[model samples]
Target chain A: MDGVHDIGGTDGLGPVGYRPEEPLFDNPWERTVFAMSFPAMASGLNLDAFRHGIEKMHPVDYLSSPYYEHWLFTMEKGLVETGLLTEEELRARTQQFLDDPSAPLPQRSDPAAAEAIVGFLRSGAPARREIDAKPAFAPGDRVLVRNLHPKGHTRLAGYLRGKRGVIDAVHGAFVFPDTHAHGLGEQPQHVYTVRFDSVEVWGPGADPRTVNHFDMWESYLVALDGDTDDRAALDR
Target chain B: MSTDHVLPVRPDYNADPTPDPVVVARVKALESLLLEKGVLASETVDRVADLYEKEVGPRNGARAVARAWTDPDFKQRLLADPVAACAELGIGGMQGEDMVVVENTDEVHNVIVCTLCSCYPWPVLGLPPNWYKYPAYRSRIVKDPRALLRGEFELDVPDEKTIKVWDSSAEVRYWVLPQQPPGTEGLSEEELVELITRDSMIGTGLPRTPDSPAGAR
Candidate 1:
């Protein structure tokens, strides 16, 4: 949903993927993350050049690092690039770790491991889903996906929300909380999908046959129109 | 860079994966700077660095996922605004911005790969595994999702579906609303919740029968 495309619809243009900027280097991934992440990380930090320095690098290495690996890596990168970590300090730390025979090291690690229930490994596992509760939206309901583009850590996409949509299908619910991504306590919430009309999202002139749906956590949406209007929207 | 055009140990573009000495140096320097600036305490930074990879990392996301699978409407709301739904579950809220969730259906499936740095939905799904950010996996997966998935993740999608690969551009993160698996419908919310594997939610794998979760990795 993000672009500089003239939304006045007077340009006679459709919803096109705005390149944002000229394609940098050859890799799209690198161009995307580098341009985005450091600025976000910079938000929490007190420095500007430090953030700029970190953003200058290609993001290929970033994709090569795991999620938090990048986090860890970036922190280190920022420190070094900004005159915080000295050449000698890194060398000393590396050398010491190599020599320390008694130092504890992590064992097997997995990135997608969190996706599967740990109980899946055990023969008899505790249930992870809570079935008795009723879901928030039904066959037809109007909802909005909040539009937010933050620098440091953000979860919202430009295209998905704000453009009006309806609730087409109701999937089961799961644990959603409000907290920092790292290990910590949480504030409980729920999730769902509110379908959007291409016409509404792209403007009244959009393809009537086309419909878009996005999954949302309850906290993201506030009802704009009731279910009946949504049902009618979906029927079209 | 994610391609197999194995670099001939060259000068520019294709560099080694070795941790950058300069970057590491910068990290240490930044730590010291933060301390000097009174922005952070050296001992606190050391403590943060110490337990970070372990303690204050991805565990919270795991708990959130487990809780979601156990609750229904929360799941629906989760399906609505992932970030807000997460807030309902007490997971994450406006540390800065909000979040949205997208469900993957039979006709249209959502696959997330960070073409840029490996930006992920860590707050909800936890930190990503190493292979996710691997050049080998990133390059091949988008061009050939079904094949690579079968090879790396051992996942196979039906031929009829169209895969919409999301190349994350901004800091905005994405997660898959994996289809809930069959056979556990009548089971208690708790039992049904047990079926919600994190991988399934990611669209990398599907939930299995209670009897079947025994063999998954």
Candidate 2:
């Protein structure tokens, strides 16, 4: 889905801010939200599904809220939507904390569970999966990024849509996020590093000395027959 | 180079000095609910935060970069199969399951970004910085990286050098293999490690020279 989160190539968002010694977390709440995300995942929320929840946020709120606030939104939404917790329960619990600053929250010491979650974080869940399918394109092949604008979740960035690029490298088949996010299936496919010259992507005026490369799944690309300017070639 | 362009100011660009109280309550509320419902133990949350704070981070990535600077074989391995190479130094996992380390040389420079989201190598460089996640960097870097690096980061690349911006739109995470600075041949791997700042690996900044103030032992 085209959302505010997909902010590549869009102009006038202002200068990038940098801090020489930025702390890991800006606020206490930020740390809590970050830490909770792992266990929330341990509680059966899919990573792609969690990302889509953030994508589903209202465009205005997505931009205004801080990063962790977005995570908090996803966690809350996932828990409720998955039937783990009710809306009233969450609202009442929030009110309790809001009303009493020193409210004693529930706690449990489960060292075994703690270690398991930390171990999982240490060794991440690898998205690469074995599929008995050959890669459609190989390195050095000229391909066109299919002009796809899916209303559902997708990894294809809007800026790269309908652009031309060359296959730089072929990564093994990985779980396709488009299907994984919707609980359809892994539907794994080969992911390639597609290289786009700056001029091709940003037009002739762009600095010819630069290039942008993106990791594109096989389905997002189409083989170009020859060096022709026919836009119709994309559909064929 | 493109300095004449007037960028729009986003009101929420900078984080507020004080966090919202309601937002604070909401997270605390969720934690309590998760615990009561047996979805998450408080210990698990604490352990996860501790791992990032104490165990994993830029130090791991710095060590890998420094090792490459000293060992040519390791550098080849890092360039060819970064995941396996980093694992030789015990620095592979999490968002770094499939890693690609691009080399920065005299003619070409490399930078990594996730235009769609903040996909960073957690076991290596740790979580991404605020600017890496914000809209300004995400939106402008891919379009005019030379301008963005020069204006915002204060690191100006010469016109002759080519900038390759890797937009990590998929699972394969990317990081920079910063060129070893001149006059650092005599330094030990440990000494070289001190010079590899997090931003250097991100391609926004260069590695520190041995005689520089920050690189001084």
Candidate 3:
């Protein structure tokens, strides 16, 4: 989905802010939202699904809200949409808190679940899988990013569509986000580090001293013919 | 305290130090619901938060950087296979499952960004800072990184050196292997660890030199 979340190469957002001593999380609520994301996923929601939830948010709300708010929205949307919790229950629970801020939350101690969550955090869930297929392009091979505009979730940034780049390295096959985000399937494919010259991406006015590299799934790229003129392909 | 005085209103909630009361209520509500529905255990959230706050962070990345600076063979291994090299140092997991370390040299410099979302190497760097997830950094960094680095971050790259920005759009996570600072030939690996800051590894700032002022970070 070409949402506000895909904000690469856009301009006039504002200047970046830096705080050298910034805390990991500002609000206690932020911590809760961050931690809950794990168990929310453990409840059968995959990472891509969670991301798509955020992507589905209204553009204005998505941009105006804080980062953790996005996480919280995703968690809530996933839980409710999956029937783990109902809207009325959530609304009543929220009202209870709003009415009595000091209300004690229900707690259940499950040391085993806690341990499992920590273990998973330490040993990540890798998406890489063995596939009996050869990569379409290799290092030094010129490739053009497919001009895709999927209505559903996709990892391909808006600016990268229709752009041309060179294959820098071939990362092993990994779960493709495009299909995975929609619960279609893992659809694991070869991922590559495609290097795009600054001029190629931003055009002639871009700074020549810089280049951009994107980790692109194989399906997102089309192999360019060796005999094809680079300039002609770029112009096209 | 008497509730009689006029309190100052923050113009921007994003910049305000105080937490939003509604957000706090909403999170507590979600927690209560999740707990009641048996979706999450009581201790799970707290434990995960503690793990990130106490155990995981940029210090882990710093240790790897320091070791790579001191050991040439390890540096080669780090560049060749980052995930295994990091695991060799007991640093691997989560968002860092597929890791790539790009080295910064005199001729080339590397930076990491995820314009799609705030995808970072969690096991090594923990949670990303607020600025990293904000629109200002995500939207503009890819287009005019030199300008952003110089104007907002105060790290000016010379015109001659090339800047390579890595957009981590897929499963692979990328980080920078910031060049070891000069005038630290005699320092031990442990001592060298102090020079590596989070921003340096993120490519917004350079590592602290031996003569840099105390508490510079």
Candidate 4:
């Protein structure tokens, strides 16, 4: 899905702002949204489900919405899907504040739960999964990214599709997100660091010496017979 | 060293104001319901917030950088397998499990960007900065990295040095091991850590010089 969130090489996004000293969260609400995301998943919402919910949003809404807003919207969607809350219930809650602006909402009964969430967040979870599979390509092999446009969730960025690169290193098997995102099994596959010349990606007049490397799953690549720089070789 | 190309005015990507009241209300409502249902406890939320706000951040990354500077074996381990090396220093987890530290050299300069999204080593560098996730950064830093480095960051890359931009497009996140600044040979590991800024690790800026005051950039 070519969503607005995939704004890698697109233009007109404006300048990169800088702050001398940045805060962890700019506001209290940002922290609130961040805190809810962990527990929402802890309560049964899968990480993929959460990501898909965000991807499901209208492009315009996604583009204009701030970062945390995306998280909040996804949290709401996940809760509704998990039978914890309904659209109307969420709407009513929003409307309640719209109507009075001073209403006291519910607070957590057990304050200790926040500690547990923090502990979990501090001791981060590793996404790498153990799997027994031979790597299709090894370091120094030439390969081309298959021109793929999967309608489902995928880590294959739009820019890297249909490009040629060299296998820099092989990072043993890890759960492939494309399959894992769809409730499809965690089909672990070898992940490789594919090194693509900046010219190979952006085309002529680009920096020839500059290389852009992407961590690609094995399923997204097809082996090239030999190292070739000709454009025609890549098309095949 | 000269190109006539004009750089666009960088936008204030951090312009998002104190979140809108309605957005606040919505999140507050969701929290209340989850709390009432016992699905999430407030204590956990508070703790997570505190962990990010105080316990974790760029300081962890500084320690890693400083250690690598002082110990050649650790630096080799960091460059070879960042996950295991970071673990030796107790800095591996979360988005950093598949970490790969790219070393910066005289002939080549390394910078990191996640064009698809903001995939950063949170456990090591803490949460990402606002600009790292901005659209302008995700777009310009790849196609015209030299421009972004010069125009926005004020760190000009010499024509002789090739800039290799690592777009973290997968589970693995990258952090730049900026070359240790010259003239700091006698500094202790703790002193070196103070010179390591978050921007240097991200490859947008160089590490702080010992003579310059902190946050001078």
* Candidate 1 lDDT by residue in tens digits, A125-156: 11124556577667677665655443432233
* True interface contacts reproduced, per candidate: 0.02, 0.77, 0.82, 0.71
Worst 10 residues of 1 chain B by lDDT: B42-51
Could you tell me which residue pairs clash in candidate 2? A124-B94
Per-residue lDDT of candidate 3, residues B88-173 (tens digit): 99999899999999999999988889999899988877888888887778888888789889898889999889999999898888
Predictions ranked by lDDT, top down? Answer: 2, 3, 4, 1
Residue pairs with backbone atoms closer than 3 Å in model 3 (clashes):
none
Docking class of 1: incorrect
Interface RMSD of 4: 2.1
Across A1-236, the per-residue lDDT of candidate 4 in tens digits comes to 67776776787877677777878788888888887888888887777667767777787777666677888998998789788899998898788877777777566666667766766775666667777667899999989898778787777888888888899988887777777766687788889999988888999988676778888999888888755654555455
Ten contiguous residues minimizing lDDT sum, candidate 3 chain B: B4-13
Which has the greatest TM-score?
Answer: 2
lDDT by residue for model 4 (B1-217), tens: 5332576344444665767888878877787778788887757666777877887788899998999999999999889888888888877666776888999999989889988668888988888888887677888888878888899898988977999888887778899998999999889999999999888999899998978874665
lDDT of 2 by residue, B95-136 (tens): 999989999999999989999889998888998988899877
What is the number of residue pairs that collide in model 3? 0
| Superior by lDDT: candidate 1 or candidate 3 | 3
TM-score of each: 0.48, 0.96, 0.95, 0.93
**Top candidate, metric DockQ:** 2
Error of 3 at A205 (Å): 1.5
- Candidate 1: regions farther than 4 A off: A1-236, B1-33, B42-72, B93-96, B213-215
Evaluated at residue A99, the lDDT of candidate 4 is 78
